[model samples]
Each structure stands twice: as structure tokens, then as C-alpha cells.
Target chain A: MWEQIRSNQTRTLVLVVAMGLLLLLVGYFLGEAIFGSGIGGLVVAILIWVVMNLFAYFQGDSMILAISRARKISPDDHPRLYNVVEEMKIASGLPKIPDIYIIDDPSPNAFAVGRDPSRASVAITSGLLERLNRDELQGVMAHEISHIKNRDVLLMTFCSVLLGTIVILAWFGSRMMLFGGARGGRRSSGGGGGYATLIIVAVAILLMILAPIAAQLIYYAISRKREYLADASGALYTRYPEGLASALEKIAGSTQELKTANQAFAPMYIINPFRSKGRAASDLTSTHPPISERVRILRSMAGGASLAAYEKAYQEVRGSGRGVIPPSALVGETPVAARKAEAVPAEPGKVERARETSDLLWKYSNYGLVNCECGTKLRVPPKLRGSSIRCPHCGRVNPLSSRP
Target chain B: MDCPACKGVVVVVEYQRIELDYCTKCYGVWFDAGELSLLAERLDLRGAALDVNQIAALPEKKAAEKARGCPICRKKMKKVTLGSAPEVLVDVCTRGDGLWFDGGEVGQVLGQLKDKGAAADEQGRVIDFLGEVFHVRG
Candidate 1:
């Protein structure tokens, strides 16, 4: 595990440096081609890189969180969810519990963000809490915790920084060439400049066309590998492979899309929250492994959850030699205790708990809840004044009055 | 605000820009002043047009059981009967904080509204008559 973390940091550093240089080179070419001055574009490119790097290091998590409109929730606000996060923190032997957050969206999705575990925050949508039973919920939390423990969040942040910069630079370069903005340089440099402009145009086309694909290919490789490792580690942490498998099925099966999930932040989620039917295992552009493939691998794990089991299953499903769990991770790895569906928390009435999960988000946001005898939980406003209430579930009328 | 029925905390969520408070334990929903109307408006359900006006006009109800304190102001709330088919009665805070409904009540209210909308729509009424005549699928 230690070796894996070290390698992860090393790879992230290498990738960032490599991508940064690529960005500067593209900038220099485009600057000379468009502005008649390579130095000006280089300066602008460097400044952009530095600013993005600073943002990714210091405030990337906050920015991502704000974009998603995530609200921080205290333990007392949601004991069930808080407990799951606490359990994972202890299991991972982390220094402290990661901050927990809730998104008001109805989609069943979750993601973790931060530079490290101690500073990390995990957010889950309201739909998730209402849908999964305890074990499944625990499974989801464990996967997120594994990402934090494995430093994948930091890797993803770096990925965002590099990919984001390159895309922006490419877009700018392409726009300039297509829209006649490069004429400034073409006209100023005179006769010899025509040949230079031709070269510039060709280079811009190449960079605009191939640079992002190259960056994305790199991003996809790192992302998919990290996902497998995280899944293995998450199963190991929870000692329950089936839980995550089933949870993934439920998440994937749902038609509800995550309303606020950003493309830049998609790689950080447990599964891509966007609408993508193509299997990530097959698609070069996907940031996640296919849902069916992942679930199949988890279900195939014999005995207890372990890296060795996952590797074996990975080979069996995707064929041998392609799985990415580090050899260091497999060393001294032991099978975790297998959990059955019986271990699921006792919630017999959850099937009837429609939209109650969103209701819970409201409760956390300072609304009131009413429990009906028919197992229907209602989300209520704080300032409500009304008469007789009919239960939507059973049609039973419950009395409401100011005085008892 | 604390849940009036249960002691659990409640959180606010926005649906179509209307903020509604919902309890984690009970799954009940609450709407604040004018929020119900706003939600109904957003839902575009026809029956809801009659709800708010009818609710304010209905006679005060005799308490059926122990009256609960308002979750927000801790005062006694007013019991207003929702007057219409698939009728609903909800407790509203006298101080105007909001109204509370047990789980699934929102669906019933919305159902009533939709039913009314369906009834009034010419195409819907025609479809219903034809589907019923042919014993069509649910």
C-alpha cells in the first residue's frame, strides 16, 4: 500500500510536468503563428499553467464542490450516513474522518475530493441514501474512502489541471486559425511570414486536433487503472464485494441523471454520472470501467474479497495481463470476510420510502418530517399550517391541530 | 426545523425552485408560505388551482388525536381540511412557517391535481373514455 501511494504520487508529478511542457510548446507555436510573437503566448501559457496549478493545489476541491452546490452536513444532521463514513475512516486507519457532504440532487451518485485523506471530503446525493440499504451504502462509502486512501483524488485534480489547460489552449488556438485572428501575424511578417503562417496553420491544426485526444488517452489510462485499484481496495476495506457489486447495479440501472455532475469532475465519481451507454472497458474515452464488467468481476470473486481474487476475476472477465492492481497491493493482502445480503441493515419498509431520501436532504437543510403509520414519511415545510392530512400512500386521514 | 412528528432533523430541498422541507425518518414533506401554490404552479396540475383557495375557506377541524406542536414556532397549528376529491387535511403553523404532510401525501395531492387536469383536458377525457371502452392497459 505504501509503495502504491508513493508510485501514485510519482506518476502524478511526472504527468503534470509532461503535460505542462506540452501545453507551453503548443502555446509557443500558436503564439508565433497567431500573435507574431512566440514569447507573448509562452508567457500567457506559463501564467495560465501556474494559476491553474495553484488553483488545483489550493482550492480545486472547493471549486468543484461549489459548482456541484454541495452543502456540508454535521453528524447530528444525518447519523446513518455519518456512521458509514466513520466506519470507513476507521477501516482505512486514517488520521481522521473525512468531511461528509450532501447534494440535493435526486440522482444516486457519490464522489470524493481533496488533496489527501485528512483534508478530503466525500459527498453523496440524496437519492443514494434513500435507495441503498446499509451494506450497499457502506460499500459505496468504502469505495470513496479507498480513493482518498490511495491518493486518486489528488491524481484526478492534477488530471483536471493539465487536461483543462491543454483544452483551453487548443480551443483558443483553433479559434484563432479558423476565424482569421492569425492574419495579424501573417500580414506583419510579410513574404517569409506566409511560409511561417502555413507552418503555424498546420501546427495549430495538429495541436487542436490531436493534443486533447492524446491528453484524454493518458487520462483514461490513469483513471481506469485507479478505478480497479479503488474497487479492489474498497471491497477489501468493507470485506464485502457483493455489496459494491449490487450497489453499482442499482446506480447504473437508475435512469435518473446526476443534474450537477461536471465533465471535468466526472472521473472522480464512483461511476460516471453522465449518460454513457458504451462500456468504459471498451470505450477509449470512458473514465470508468463498464458497470456490467465491474459487477461481473465482483460477483466472480471467490472466497473473500482480496486483490488476488480481483486480479483473477479481472483476468477471467477482461482476459489476462490487462488489470492494473499494483503488485505491492497484492503483497501481504488477505481475503476479507465475505458479507451476505442478510447483513443488510434492517429496513423492511424502504420500498415504500419514495422520495423520502430527498426529504431527508430537506431535513438536513432545516425542514420538518412527518412519519405516517402506513410507512410513508413526508417532508414538510417549517411554517406549515393546515387541516386534515390524507396519506398519499394509504389514504388514511391523520389529524393535525395546534392543541392536543 | 425539527420534525414535528419525529425528533429527527429535517433539511430543505428545491424542486422547480420551490424549497420544501422533508424529514429523513418520516419521509413527510412540508411547504412554506406560498410554496405549495408555487410547486403546484410549477407542476402545472389543474386541480391544485382549487386547493389553496379551498383550504383557506374550509371550516376549522376538530382535533382527531393529540395535536402536535409546530416544528418551527412550537405553537399550536391550525388544522385545515383540503376540500376536494381525494381530499387531504394537513396541519399548518398558525404563525405561517409552513404546512406538513405525512409520507406519500404529496403524491395524493399531486394526484388529485393531475386527475383534475386530466378530467378537464378534452384529449385526456376522450382517451380515458376510449381506453375504458376498450379495456386498455394501465
Candidate 2:
């Protein structure tokens, strides 16, 4: 695990440097095209990159939570979720347990975000809670915690911020070239350096069009690999590949769409948010690998839950290519046997699970509950706190106080 | 969520995990995109009686009432007619956020659905539950 983390950090540095170089190059060309010099554009690019890095380093997690409309919850809000996260925390040997958040959307998905393991947080949708059972929930939580433990969260944060900067700079440059190029063109036409200026402007336009696409491709490539690594680590932590495999199957089978997910935030989710029916074509542009392939890899791990086991399964499933887990991390690794499933009480029915999930969301939304004597539970919103509500089932009038 | 019709604050009333937001002032009910289906499922009415997507995809109706904003997205909702005889006009969010039924419209719409046959018994249960909850009769 330590070796994986170190390698991840090194890769993160290389990614940042590569993206930074791309940004600077784009900036220089755009500056020269627009202002007849590359210095101004390069400075602006550096400034944007630095400012974004600082912002992301300090407030990235909060920003992600805010965008997803996730609310923080203590153990009392959902004991099952908390317990699973705690179990994974201990299993992964993390310094601090990541704060858990719940998004109200009905889509089944989850993601992790933070600067490092100690500062990390995991967010799960209400739909995910409503659908997944104990073992499956543990599987999902373990995957997210693995993301934190392996330092992928930090690397992803920096990469996303850099990607955002590149996209913005490219967009701005293209718009400037379209709307403000006349002045530059006229000036160049009047000078002896007309041909040189025209060539520079043409090159700048081409770069602007290609830069964002290039950055996105790089981001997607890195993100997809990290997902597989996290899955491997998660299985190792839980010592149960079936748990995650089943969870992935459930998530992929769900038809409900996550309302909060957009193109920019799609990569952060466990499954690609904008999923389509055409599997092969979508795989190239998707942030995560195809769900079927991931499930196949997990289900094929015949040995056990060790990194070596996962690597072997991965190679076998992918037809003998280089495996996902780093070679150094698997050196001298003994096969870790998959644990038996934990004994749980009679599993809750679908309706029961839905009720639990909705009850939690209602509580978070500050809906006051009033139980009627006839067995109907009425949830009154805060707006109706001072008013009385009648039971829908039994027609009993329930009085409400201004404050609970 | 604010009532699309009355622009007044709406209170959520939940029973068996099916939540509905209704305005206290206008007594208008708001059924979020999937809540109606949830209610139908609770009542075991499994057919096409409450397919929200189908209802949302219904052609727009030209109504005299002014367009109202959706409580979820705050975008102007379109007027659509649901069911046949005495066609009930309801406000459906263009973005599929929810449907807004004015004062007695919920009962009217369900009453029409019940009259449409086949699932009348199950539909009656939903109507009865809503009537008792909101103190209205279909």
C-alpha cells in the first residue's frame, strides 16, 4: 500500500508538471496571437494555475460537496453507513476516518474527495443507501476509503483543477481570436512582420481547439486507471471481491439518473454518471472502465483478495496485458483469503430500505415527524411547524408546535 | 419548495415514504417526479396509471391560467391535461422536476384515473389516503 501511495504521488507530480507545461504553452501562443508577445499570456496562465491550485488544495472538498448538495451527517443519522465506513477505516489503517456525507439524489453512486487521507471525505447518494445491503455497502465504502488511502484523492483534485484551467484558458483564447482578432490582424497587415504574425495566429487557433480535448483525454486516462486500482485495494481491504462486484452490478443496473452530475464532475463518481447503452463507444470517453469488465475482473479472482490475485485476474480478463496493480506493490505478497460473509439479521425488504433512506432525508430536510395513534407517520415540513396537520391514514388531527 | 400556483411556502407530508409538498394557503399539491409512482407502488398499482415520464411527455395544453414556476428548478412549468372526461389541467415542470396540481385537482385527477377502469380499487385506496391526509374527498 505504501509503495502504491508513493508511486501515485510520483505520478501526480509528473501529471502536474506535464499539464502545467501544456497550460504555459497554450498561454504563450494565445498571448502572442492576441498581443504580439507571449509573456503576458504566459503570466496569466501561471497566475490562473497557481490561484486554482491554492483554491483546490484548501477548499476542494467543500466545493465538491456544495456542488453535489451533500449534507454532513453523524453516526446517528445513518448507523449502517457510519459503521461500514468505520470498518473500512480500520481495515485500511488510515490516520483519520473520512467524514461521511449523503447526497439526496435517487441515483446510486458514490465518490471520494480530499487533499489526503486525513482530510478526505466520502459521499454516497441516498439511492445507494436505499439499494445496497450490508456487504455491498461495505464494499462501496471500502472502495472510496481505498481512494483516500492510496492518495488518489489528492492527485485527482490537482488534475481536475489543472484540467479546468486549461479548458477555461482555451475557451477564452478561442473567443478572443473570434471577436478580437480584427485589431491584431489589421496591425499585422500594416507591419513588415505580416507573414510571421499570420502564422502565429493560425497556430494559436489550432492549439486553442486541441488543448482542452488533449487535457480531457489525459485526465480520463489517469482517472480510469485509478478507479481499477481503488477497486483492487478495496477488495484487499474488505477481503471480499463478491461484495464490490455485486454492488457494481446493482449500481450499473439502476436506471435513475443522478441530477447533480455534469460532464465536469462525472469522473469523480464510482460509475460514469452520463451512462449510455452503447458500451464499447462510450468506454473511450467514460471516466470509469465498463462495469461489465470490472465485474468480470473481480469475479474471476479465483485465488483470493490479495493484490497478486487481483493482478492475475485482471490480466486474465483483459487477455494477458500488463496488470493494473503495480509490480513493486505485489512483490513477495502472500495470497490473502477472502473472508466469509458476515451474518446479518433477515435482510430488509425493498420497501423497508426505501423507508429508512427517505426517513433519513426527511430528517436532514428538517421535517418534523408526528406519529398518529392509528399507525400513520406524518412528516411536517418546517414551514408548517406552527400549524396543525391531520393524519392522512386515520384523519386524526395532529397538533404541531412552533419548535420541536 | 414554494407552491407554483400560490407562491407560498409548501409543507411536505410523508406517509410510508411517499412525500408530497402542498401549499397551506392554496392547498395545492406538488408530486415530485417519482413520488407519485412511489405512492402507486405503495398501493400496489403497478401498471401505467402513474408513469411520471409519460405524463411529463404529454403534449402541452393551451390554458387560460398563467404559467407558474416549478418549486424545484424555479422554471416556468407548462400546462398539461391528464385523463379524459372533465380533463384535469395540471402544471408539469418542463424539466421533469414534478407536477403541480391546484387545490382540488389531485382528487379530480385521481378520480378520473379511477374512472379510466381496471385499477379502480387500488386508485381508490390512494385517493382515500390522500383525502384523509389533506381532509378532502374525491
Candidate 3:
């Protein structure tokens, strides 16, 4: 595992550096096209990169959570979710349990974000909580925790921020060139260097257009592989591959789209947020590997829950010689037997699960709950100025302010 | 979410895990994207009466009622008729945020589901629930 982490860190560094170079190159050309000197653009690019890196390092997780409209919850809010996370934290040897958050979207999905395991947080949709059972939920949590443990969250954070910067720079450059580049080139061309200036502007425009696409390609390339690793690690953590396989199956089967997700943040989710049913498995641009393929690989891990077992299963499923896990990490790794499904006491039924999830949403939304004598629970919205609400079921008036 | 018609804060009324945002003053109801289906599924109404996709696909209706903004997106919602015999005009967010039923419209539209010959028991349960929930004194 340490070997895998170290390799991941090295690869992340290489990728970040490569993306940085791309940013600088785009900057240089834009500078030359506009200012007739590459130095100015290169300097600005470096500054942008540094500031963005700092911001992503310090505030990336919060930004993501806010964008997804995720509300933080304590153990009292949802004990089952907290327990699963706690169990995964202990199993993965994490220093501290990650903060948990829930999104109100009906689409089932989850993701992890942080600079490190200690500072990490896991967020799942309300639909995910309502749909998944104990073992399946554990499987999903383990996968997210594996992302934190493997430092994939940090890598993705940096990559997304960098990608955003490049896209913005490219957009600004293209607009500037369209409106002002010709004049700048015309002025420089009058100085006996008109042709060269025009050519540089053209090249700059082309590079500006291609830089974001190139960055996205690189970004997607790095993200897809980490998902498989997380799955393998998640299975190892829980010693159960079927749990994750079925969880993935359920998530993919849902037709609902996550309203808060955008292209930049789509890759951070467990499954591609934008993916619909029947998408081809080998889509090169997708941030996630195909759900069917991932489930197949996980289900093929029949031997046990171990890095070696996962690698064997992965190769067998893919019918390739290459292994997903690092060779060093697989060395001397013995297969650990898969655990039987735990019979959680008094497991809530589907309706109960749905109620619990909605109750949490109501709590976060500042809704006041009023239990009617006829058994219908009324949730008054916070902004409701009325002192009393008539029960929808029993037609009994329930006073709001008198509860305290 | 505020009621699209009354522009007043709406209270959420939940029964059997189906949450409906109801306004106290106007007795209007706001059904976020999937909640209607949830309500229908809970009532075991297998018909297309409450289908969001079908309702959204309904042609825009020219009405005298003033357009209202969706509480979630604040976009101007389109007026569309829901039922055939006595068309109940409702506001649907162009962005698919939700459907907004004006005061008494929920009962009027849901009550018509019985005419379509959907299972009487299921239709009766939903209509009864909606009628009891949205019952407001003039």
C-alpha cells in the first residue's frame, strides 16, 4: 500500500508539472501575440499557477462542498453513515475520521475531497443513503476513503484548479485576440515585422484554443485509473468485493442526473455525474471507467480481498498482461478471506430509510417537525410565518411556536 | 421554497416519506422534480397523470394568470394545463426545477385521475390525501 501511495505521489507530481508547463507555454504565446514579448505572459502564467495552487490547497474542498450544496452533518444527524465511515477509517488505518456531508439531490452518488486523509471529507447524495444497505454503503464509503488515503483527492483538486485556470486564460486570450489582437499586430507590423507578428498571433490563437482541450485530456487520463485503484483498495479495506460491485450497479442503474454537477467537478464523483445509460464502456473522454466493467472486475475477485487478489481479478477481467496495482505493493500480499454480510440489527426498511434521509434534509433546512396525533409528521419550512399549520393528513391544526 | 402563486414561504407537509411544500395562505403546493413521482409511486398510481416528463412535455398554455418565478431558480415558469376535462393550469419551471400547483389546483387535477380509469383504490387514496392536505377555507 505504501508503495502504491508513493508511486501515486510521484505520478501526481509529474502530471502537475506537465500541466504547469502547458499553462506557461500558453501564457508565453499569448504574451508574445499581445505584448510582442513572451516574458510578460510567462511571468503572469507562473503567478496565476502559484496563486491557484495556494487557493486549491487551502480552499478547494470547501469550494467543492459549497458548489455541491452539501451540508455537514454530525454523528447525531445520521448514526449509520457515521458508523460506516468510522469503520472504514479504522480499517484503512486513517489518522482521523473524515467529516461527512449530504447533498439533497435525488441522484445517487458520492465523492471525497481533501488535501490529506486527516483533513478529508466524504459527501454522498441523499438518494445514495436512502438506496444503499449496510454492506453496500460500507462498500461506497470504503471507496471514498481509499481516495482520501491514496491522496487522489489532493491530486484531483490541484488538477481541477489548474484546468480551470487554463480554460479561463484560453477564453480570455481568444476574446482579446478577436477584438484587439489585429490592432496590436497591425501596430507591430508597421515596424517592419508585420508578417511575423500576424503569424505569432495566429499561432497564439490556435494554442489558446487547444490548451484547455489538452489539459482536459490529461486530466481525464489521470482520473480514470485512480477509480480502479480506489475500488481495489476499498475492497481490501472491507474485505468484501461484492458490496462495491452491487453498489456500483445500483448507482449506475439510476436515471436521475445530479443537478449541481458540472463538467469540471464531474470527475470527482464515484461515477461520472453526466453519464447516462448505454454509454459505451471505452469512452476515452469519460473520467470514470465504465460501471459494468468496474463491477465485472470487482465481481471476478472471487478468491479473497487482497491487493494480489484484486490485481489477479483485474487482469483476468480485462484479459491483459498489465496489473492495476503496483508490483511492489502486490509483493508478498496474501489473500484475506472475504467476510460474510453483516446482519445489522433492526435494519430499516426502504420507507424508513427514505424518512431518515428526508428528516436530515429537513433538519439542515431549518424545518420544524410537528408530529400530529394521527401519525402524520408535518415539517414546517423555516420561512413559514404562520404560528400554526393544519395537518395534511388528520386536518388537525398544529401550532408551530408552542413546541418549545 | 416559496409558493409561486402567493410568493409566501411554503411549509413542507410529509406523509409516508412523500414531502409536499404547501403554502399556508394560498394552500398552493410545490413539487420538486422527483417528489411527484414519489407521491404517485407511494399511492401506487401507475398511470401517466402525475408523470413529470409527460407534464413537462405538455404544450404551453396561453392564460390570463400572471407568470410566476420558480422558487428554486427564480426563472419565469411556463403556464401549462394538466388535465383534459377541466384543465388545471399550473406553473412549471422551464429549467425542470419543479411544478407549482396554484391554490386548489392539486385537488382539481388529481381528482381527474379517476376519470382516466386508473386503479380506483390507488386513485382514491391519492385524491383523498391531496384533498385533505390542500383543503383551505375561502
Candidate 4:
């Protein structure tokens, strides 16, 4: 494990340095065209780029949060969620507690942002809270905390920014070569080296186009491996690989799409938001290991006392006809089969009605409430409200103001 | 525009010919749903937060108008107001369906409710202290 971590560290460092070098090359080439490559001009352009990127680094959290429509929650507003995050923070030994944010979207996803744990924030969608049980929720939360613990949040952000700059430079180079070069030639009255300049510009454009993409493939490779590392570490942290594995299954099963998501925030999710379902893991372009593969690994981890036993058991479990029960179900005192047999019928229309109510409440609550029985104290799903809820404890449903 | 549910004002900001309606407090957007997608085809549109203000000049008849059923509950929904802010009343379905916020109302309603909760906490503390002095527990 240590050897793998060392290898991963080496790989990530190489990728970051490669990205940096790519950015520098693109910057230099673009700079030479815009401002003749005197030492002073080069310095001035590089300085400006660095200064601007630095500003983005400091304010990036706020800007991203706002753009994503994530709203902040105080501990007073969401005690359970606040407490969960607090516990995770302590367990992970983070210097400061990250702020929590709630997105109204119904997608079962979460992400961490900020330059590091000290400045980080975690955001979860209402759908995630609604769908996941307490243990499953813990598993997912642990995975995100693992990202913070491993400093992947900072690393991914830096990689993304650098990659973005490279892409921009590439685009600028292409646009200039296609249009600007001809104009430049017109201005220079067909100078002897004009065609040579055009060829350089064309080659520069091609390199520029290819550079960022190549850099991003490297970025995704590093990012994907970090996810696998976080998954392993998170299971270690919670002592329950099945918990996260089950959570991932639920996340996979959920059909609700995240409305606020774009390519930029896609990598931060526990599962890739943009992933096409049913694709095989052997396809290397994927930003995440295939869900099936991840679940298989986790189930293997859950099957035995030692990692070797886990591997052996995992192979058997995969090969044998026995389907792995969800970790939560398996962890319960009773066998899941007995529980299934003992399960009560849905009281006629009750299940259907509840499903309907759940959907309606889900959309209206911005997917916030889970089991709001009119006679029960409007039971919301546990955690992640970013606000307080009323109980139907007395069977007297209190009218809540929509204004508030 | 005010959120029909919360009565918080919604603001329309213009960049060129396009207009967007956004709520300051709740951050919920009001468009004809897919209209924004169409608008995004040409313009670089993003949300701009608005500040809440009740439209005092609107007729009281609009205030009296009630939605027929809770959108989520399929049952009657009630309009309730926070004690601290009598002017703002929200129609909470409470039956596990969703609560509606007028286009601009979500923020004010949520903000005022938070303040009301803080006030309630203080009052509860005082009441508990008085109960201790009086030995009121059965």
C-alpha cells in the first residue's frame, strides 16, 4: 500500500510539473506573438498571468459556490449535518471545519472545494440526503473527507486552473493562426518570411490545441487514482467498505440529474457526474474506475479479516452465484432474507401514495424532506437540511410559512 | 415580481435584450422553465442575487388569493406568518409536498424564519428558567 502511495505521489508530481511546463510553453509562445519576446516583455506577460491566476486562487471558492447556486448553512440551521461534518473534521484532523453548503438539485452527489482543508467547503445535494441511510451517508461523507485528508481538493483545483489556461492559450493560438496571421501578412506587405511565419503559426496552433487535452488526460489519470485511494482510505476510516460501496450503488441507481453541474465541477463528485452508464472499466478514458469494479473491491474488503482473504473472497463472491447484500443490510443483526420475509406489505395504497407524496414533497422541498408523515412530526430525512424542520409528533400538523 | 408563495420581491435585471428574474434570499429562479436554456444560446447568462422588498402598492386582493391545493400534498395548504415578521406569510404544504415561493420570496421567507427561530430559542430559554424557579414540572 505504501509503495502504491509512493508511486501515486510520484505520478501526481510528474503530472503537475508537466502541466506547469505545458502552461509555460503555451504562455511563452502566445506571449512572443503578442509582445515581442524580449526578456522584459516575457517577464511582464508571465507576471500578469501569475498575478491574475493568484487572484482566482484566493477567490475561487466564493466564485464557484455562487455560480453553482450553493447556499451556506449555519450549525444552528442544520444541527445534524453540522455535527456530522464536525465529527468528520475532528476524525480527519483538519485544521478548521469546512463550511457546508446545500444545492437544491435532486442529484445524489457531493463535492469538496477550496485550496486546502483550511479553506475547504463541502456541498451536498438534497437528493443525496433523501436517498441515503445514516451509515451510507457516513460512507459518502468519509470519502469526501478522505479527499481533503489526501489534499486532492487543492491538487485538483491547481491542475484544473493550469489546464484551463493552457486550453485558452491554445485557443488563442489557433484563432490567431487562422485569421490573425493573414492580417499580419497583409500589414507586413508580403515580407520574405511571411509564409514561414504562417507555417510556425499553424504548427503552434496544432501544438496548442493538443497540449491542454494531453495535459487534461494526465490530470484525469491522477484524479482517477486519487479517487481509488480515497475510497480505500475512507473504508479504513469508517471500518466499513460496504457502507461506501452501498452508497455508490444508491448513487448509481438514482435517476435524478444535477441541474447545476457542468464540466468544471464534474470531477469533484464521488462518482463522475458526466459518466455514461454501462461502460466497461477497461475503457481507460474514464475519470472514475467503473462502478462495478469499485463495488467489487469494496465487497471484497468487507468479506474477510485480512486484505488477502478479501481478495480471495472477492474472487469467490464474484465467481459464485451469491450476490453480495448491501453492507447496511448485511450489518444488521438479522439476516436480510429473514428481514425480507418479515417485511410488511405496503398497506394497500400506502406505498404508492407515499411514493407519490415523496416525489411531490421532494420537488417542492427542493428534495429536502424525506418521510414527512402528516400525523408524525413532519419527519424529514436525516441531515443536510441547512434549516430546521417541524415534527408532526402530536399528530397535529402545524402550518409552516412558505415565506420563511 | 413577488413569489406567489412567500411574497418576496423578484428582480429582473437586463443585459442587452435579455431579462432574468432572481430572488435575493432563496436564490430560486423564475423562468418559464426551459426559457433560460433557449436564452443561453446567445448570451452568457448567470444568476444575480436580488434584495427582498414587499410590493406594498399591489392590491390586497392579490394577497387574499389562495392556491387551491398544496402542490405536493394534494391537500389544502395553509398560509402562516412568522410572529416577528407579520408582513410575510408563507403557504406551507407540510404534507411532504413542496412549499412554493413567489418568484422572489424564497430568500426573505427563509431568512425571516431563521430569525424567528433564534427569537424562539431565546424565549424558550427564558421560559425554562421561569419553570425551574416555579418548580413547574409535573
Task: Provide the RMSD of all predictions against the true structure, rounded to 1 decimal.
Answer: 12.7, 3.8, 3.6, 16.4
Alpha-carbon local distance difference test for all models: 0.70, 0.79, 0.81, 0.54
> For residues A157-243, could you state the per-residue lDDT of candidate 3 as single tens digits?
878888888887888788877876545566774797777777788888888988998899888877987888899999999999999
Better of 2 and 4 by TM-score: 2
True lDDT of residue A189, candidate 1: 60
The best-first sequence of candidates by TM-score reads 3, 2, 1, 4
Instruction: Report the lDDT tens digits of candidate 2 across residue range A286-395.
Output: 78898889999888888499888888899998997877777778877888999877777787756677788888888888877787677666666776535667654456
lDDT score for candidate 1 against the true structure? 0.70
Which ranges of candidate 3 are over 4 A from the true structure? A6-17, A182-188, A191-198, A276-280, A342-345, B31-51, B54-101, B107-125, B132-138
Model 3 pairs in collision: A189-A194
lDDT of 3: 0.81
In candidate 1, position A216 carries an lDDT of: 78
Which candidate achieves the best TM-score against the true structure?
3
lDDT of each residue in B8-72, candidate 2, tens digit only: 76766665556777676777888776566667776777876566556667898997888888787
> What is candidate 4's lDDT per residue for A71-184, written digit by digit as tens?
787776555567767877776677999898877555678888887778888888766755565556667887888787777777777777777767766776667656665343
Ranking of all predicted structures according to DockQ, beginning with the best and ending with the worst = 3, 2, 1, 4
Q: What does DockQ give for each predicted structure?
A: 0.03, 0.32, 0.40, 0.02
Candidate 4, position B22, lDDT: 35
TM-score of 4: 0.57
**Where does the lowest 10-residue lDDT sum fall in candidate 4 chain B?**
B48-57
In Å, candidate 1's interface RMSD is 14.4
Please tell me which model should have the higher lDDT, number 3 or number 4: 3
C-alpha TM-scores of all predictions: 0.69, 0.85, 0.87, 0.57
